[model samples]
Target chain A: MSDKPIALDAMGGDHAPHEVVAGAVHAVRERGLSVVLVGPPRVLYEALEDHRATKEVPIVRADEALAMDEGALASLRRPRSSIAIACHLVRQGNASAAVSAGSTAGIVATGRLRLKGLPGVLRPAIAVALPTLPKPTLLLDAGANADAKPEMLVQFAHLGAAYAETAFSIGKPRVGLLTIGGEAEKGNKLTRRAHELLTASPALHFVGNVEGHDLLTGLADVIVTDGFTGNVALKTMEGAVQYAFTELRNTVNAHRAARLGALMQRGALRDLQRRLDSEAHGGAVLLGLTGTVVIAHGSSRAAGISAACQLAADLEKGGVVTRIGERVASTHRTHRLW
Target chain B: MSDKPIALDAMGGDHAPHEVVAGAVHAVRERGLSVVLVGPPRVLYEALEDHRATKEVPIVRADEALAMDEGALASLRRPRSSIAIACHLVRQGNASAAVSAGSTAGIVATGRLRLKGLPGVLRPAIAVALPTLPKPTLLLDAGANADAKPEMLVQFAHLGAAYAETAFSIGKPRVGLLTIGGEAEKGNKLTRRAHELLTASPALHFVGNVEGHDLLTGLADVIVTDGFTGNVALKTMEGAVQYAFTELRNTVNAHRAARLGALMQRGALRDLQRRLDSEAHGGAVLLGLTGTVVIAHGSSRAAGISAACQLAADLEKGGVVTRIGERVASTHRTHRLW
Candidate 1:
């Protein structure tokens, strides 16, 4: 719906090139979205021909790609990487947004270099939408700022609130501080200070502290914490979910009766699985950037890539950056504590 | 096995004197362990009479009892509380260990106030055994110290290693510091410093850094972290498991075939559930204390209480506290950095 198409990094992700190209084609055909695949032109051209749609999706040539195992230094080492080229496309107004299932550190470093930050933004945060019941819960600072000042966390609340309002269409989204206890005085120094600031800020609809058990209870629209804590909590939950599913599978196949039962209830089980899937919510988002950037999971398949494109497009169209700018502008006028 | 009985707080947990008395009886009759019920004699006597266990377990008199919701301050307020009396009994050598299905903060506070700490031990940590495949993983500092120093983490590793050696009979337990990355340099100030200290300590078998996702993979025998992060990680996994089982139950009830299959696989499902059950691990153990102390879940029933008693008895017999004292004494001699 924007003037420019979304630029997809075809050389990113665990199953790069092949799965990425297939996702691009699927998005074009199924969702009626315009996409530009950025990678080696010859490889992309051949893949597009194999999909039997060479003319529909265009390819932009990029000589190199950031390795999956590389860190922030990769952004500098491979300036012409597919992810870098995608960011360049967004910066030049040739693309509405950028989506990549690449190394998070590399994507973040390059995004900052290319798109830069909006005015008054201290640091960009990664917000992952948890597939909780009724509606999804957005957890911010998933991994961007490993060490954070109290002001950064308060800013994350504003950023998360804006994303929740735009993406989930919620009015005055309630923001909760992720800490050890329900009381405001709980948690380490960073969380305690941030809690006080968030409470005083008129922009965020601040709720009391929330524990890890509240993540799936849909207790808050936005949960804010330091990147280190957030990242640990997220990964721990993900791994536990996998373990539970494994146990469930082993139990279901224990006997003929359970197997038959599992087959009959297969529809409901699949629905629940889809609802809880991380890909359903797209991926972790980098907030506070000048342009919309979505970093999909490194192991994401075609479905995840398509959802990442959808998330990037929706964020751009919804004016998330403009909303953040307005919030920062108002905070500057009223509170100068930070 | 020891000459002394395991003390149980009869007025603790959701089920109160009834479940506690029943659990004490079960520990004696089923597990061949001696247990003493600590509470008001009249209240405990009547409950024991109801279970026909009046003659099986001995009753210890305590004038006051700490409420399940009461915290650290309760130790000062109710000096004669059942939990405080249990700790006193252990210190007096009348009871080899203390087990309470009560507030973790209350138990930790009272245990510190009554039993004191081993020499050279900085702070006590609560270790929970995670039911990972192949073996149970021990996670320490599980809500004992909300704020910890770098040196405290290193000490925690030593404490956890001692526990793993004594309880699981492992020659040299592998210790992992829970952090964001496997690389040594990828954490906040606390973890970074702790990693360096742990690596340098000759007493522990340091296995470098382990991420949150590695909690259930049996990657290490002992995982050491600050109490706040450990509690969050543990509770998050518990919540996710609950959600998964709920979904599984819903799917099984979706149709007749699934229901029949679930019925057929009932034994295997129950076995898996029992293996993953928190109560089966016999609650969290308080290390670095002068005497063995186990804190059970607040909602624990008769079975969970009995398991906690079993854990307390096992730790006391295995001389977990003695092993910690030896480790601390050696670390004091060589690793004077802490």
Candidate 2:
């Protein structure tokens, strides 16, 4: 059991204090998880009072909060921001993990500066679980280091593999290098060199290369790429899914028979949507940090926030941070790249 | 008017020779387009015979063929390969364009080497039409230059704009920089720098930065990015769509009601698939080259090949290569980055 509560940034995300407070209440009441809301006292208190859960969750007062539109520089400028304060709580061992739905840039930048990286972590990465058959595939450096060296990619592979092993209980997770082609030689200069390093590393169960199409096929348990490519790929998948659903809805509406058919299968269709929802997976986990950190979707509502808190608590309980530390340390010892 | 036939690579793709021959036959008989098949005479002649159109479609003898598994270097090694021969026909003024359902790397490399880049073009890029509403959004650097200079991105904008204007009849195509965030400063080093250059260029109606989610939303008429990210985004979209459909199929089959509904709406669902098919857009076009080139999907069947040939002929007639030449030259003169 986690002794420390999850430090939640109440003022982060588009929904802010209201949804965040509701989510905190749900986590405490429904999920039985300890959570500490971090934001301006009066605003958060009023929001929590709306749900009549002021007694259930504790408050860590922080006057300043990073705006949703603010970028990474805001992390440095607004040191007392809600996200920063949440990170501060985790750093001080008052909390087990930091959960935020603010600007990804701000969360990543603040987490790096506040919680700091693990012993051998070059850069903290964002690891996301992609919904796939059998189990989810973990993709990393989802947006942490936009520009990455070949060595950083090798570290990402380890980070992703360790997380998959710890989080999904998969032994020897097959690591893959994401690039343009399935062939080893096909990619940009960065990926080409990274492929060579990944292939040479004995620590990983290296699966040569996986194309973008392979991301959802469960071809590899852990797929590693630079933050830029990873971010684009993630967003592209989001957009594609949204577009397809829109098209499907339009198709169902175009004809009388289709409409009747869709009505009959409505429950099943909704279930499929729920299974593919990012919020259900607890958003994206920021790996390689000194403490457990979960960055929920910026547009997350009450349910998403609650799911993120649950994930943060689960990751803390699973010892993902320590597992990552051990894996990185062992790999570094064998490879001597660091 | 296109003066010569489109040079088709017969010994390319998974269903090579047979499907390629059938497509060529379809182009001549159905689409009213002229096409010349390039491959081994004995094999191609026999393939043409199977279609019973040996005399209808002419054959260009090329003893060698690049295997589907071959990469860019294969373009250099096998000068007589079907794809290489197709490019040679375009270079020699015997064909108006080159059409191939071959290895993209082999096609792009051979196209660059044989057909060559235009005078002001920095690097030739592959442009694909995304299946969106109103009109398809054109995404470039689809797989051409894995690595790109900021200046090269400016050239891509011009290239894409010209193609959109000529191909889609858009007088001023709005160009968007594909990156992680919608803000100008939100991408990696390459995209950030490219954003600055794209914003400064007067030749483009640059609408500023767009995210992966915007790819299908039709926010911008032309979206430009480095080839690595573009290729990944494209494939990711493809994978996501395929996965969604697969899940929908499972959802439909899960319940008797859903199955009955799906049966009733089968026609509408099939129509939806056709609307989103890559083959319907005539595959992807290689721009900024001296000669027009079309690279069909590697697994293209007769219909895909025919669509690619028709697209190749249309692009040749539209003078996309010349339009791109003028656009790049004008931008280079104004910007002076090259």
Candidate 3:
């Protein structure tokens, strides 16, 4: 891979400009990776001063930025938005990849517009790697398309299969369709049709239908579903994890000995927390794009932003796009669904 | 109500007959409840011998029973099934309520066939009380109908609202439509349409829309969605809780101090576990039926079976069916939806 740096959206996320710049500097210094910050020159330059990285990390000026509260339309409204500029950098080969912690809708919309989709790719999917036993499970369409056709789901399976092979090195990745029941006949109209298509497809190692409970059990390498259900399932799992920890903390605090014990084993507990943390994986990747586009968590700080940069660089090196494109093209040719 | 007993499916669940008979005896002596065990007379009588409950708990013969793996079709195939007989007891006024731990689909199909729906009810929904802070949040359509129309969701909200009010004593219970986003227009076609209808309905205290993460936050008294999404969400939450506990256990056992601390705080931890246990809520209630019907977990033992019976008896006393009927009647009359 060329020494093309990852373009970081500086004016994005909750602690943007500063945290993002700090993360870029951390990547360059700690991880030995090149990064280019994208945002207004004055704002980014001032933020980079804290890390003494003004000269080390290059800055690409983006005049306007989409508000955090804005939707997909903001990508069109602010053509020079930090996320847009980051995508442009990837498109122009100035950067190997784009990483942004901006509004999910805005980033997805702009990435689609700037990088476009792989040939025969009906729609791009936001693939999130879930923390499960054995290995991370790849769940796709995590919010890219709220509504999806059966054909799109079949395509998603192939996209996820390729991603698993490239990112996680899972050969012949088993794919499961997310639905209410394990039976193939079960689920809503869309799922039933998709189940049939997936079962018939030769490219995907279809494992039939899996319920939401199978998500954390590592039943399949990739779980494919419409973006709405996928997004809800993802968030619901996150909330449950937090709720459990809060309950655990309260239990430990209820007794003195328990609190002392928790203190004693705080190291192991921290390790568990880190392993389960959503930000540890460096955010969701927008797959089926022409380039590697990583969407960092919105509330990410320095560590999360830096992790995302590292992930973008890794995905670029692993050739995720080319793998997905080839897989999609082969599936599209064989199935002729998309 | 009258001295009408709860008709229990002695042929249902993992430890059926024995556990069912034991639970009946427990419910009678501990809670002062009338109970009738429905199964093959010989099997129930032989099992009841262990508890010396043969004389204390009445037995009603139901020659046939549905299998654990059976679906909705089994309800018709085995008209004399224990679950069918239990529902028959409810319809015949011999039992005020029915409790079963058989296949959910079989119980639902039998209940719909025997008790039928309330006056204005279109489709029945399974309502489960989620273990959440403040109070258990009621989630409906846990898997009765895999597919639902937009208007069906409107009815589900009213069903859930009535259940929440009757079961939890929440007045003007706020109902939330489950969606991908908090915005009214953020979900797919069904959810988006349901959101609009819910927002317009004067019969409900609709609280816009809630994401999957809101399931355990007690954000709304009742969360309503299509059966498929609701089932997936409910199972996902359960899976997440189990995963967290497993992880916590591993962390606690990682060191001697942590294990000792866990032992010292076992009381508080047990209380938390009980509070979060789905079984503690006495399983799920099938709503919109003419009579109250509670479906215990299929793997439920004696204590869980007793809890389900208690829940059925409580719902009968709470007038859940009557309340739902009146609410649906007025709403249907007001909107002419039916």
Give the per-residue lDDT of model 1 (tens digit) for A1-338.
Answer: 47589999999899998888989998889987889999999999999999997999999999899988887877987889999999999888899889999988889898988887989999999999987766788998888888889999888988998898888898889899888887777787777888888889987799889988887788999999888888888888878877887766666665555455647356655666655665423568888987888998887788888888888878888888889989887887778655
What's the TM-score of each model vs. the native? 0.95, 0.95, 0.96
Colliding residue pairs in candidate 2 = none
Question: What shift in Å separates residue A131 of candidate 1 from its native position after superposition?
Answer: 0.7
TM-score (chain B only), all candidates: 0.93, 0.94, 0.93
How well is each residue in A54-120 modelled by candidate 3, as lDDT tens digits? Answer: 8999999898888788888878888888899999999988999999988888899999989978888
Model 1 alpha-carbon miss at residue A233, Å = 1.1
Query: What TM-score does structure 2 among the candidates reach?
Result: 0.95
> In model 2, what lDDT does residue B35 have?
92
Q: Against the true two-chain complex, what DockQ does each candidate achieve?
A: 0.62, 0.81, 0.74
Q: Please, what are the lDDT tens digits per residue for candidate 3 over residues B147-225?
A: 8898888888888888777767889999998888777668899899998888888989998899988888889988998
Q: In model 3, where do residues sit more than 4 Å from their true spots?
A: A255-271, A279-281, A336-338, B255-271, B279-281
Clashing residue pairs in all predictions, respectively, total 4, 0, 0
Better of 1 and 3 by TM-score: 3
lDDT of 2 at B319: 82
Residue B116 accuracy (lDDT) in model 3: 78
What is the descending DockQ order? 2, 3, 1
Query: Best by DockQ, which number?
Result: 2
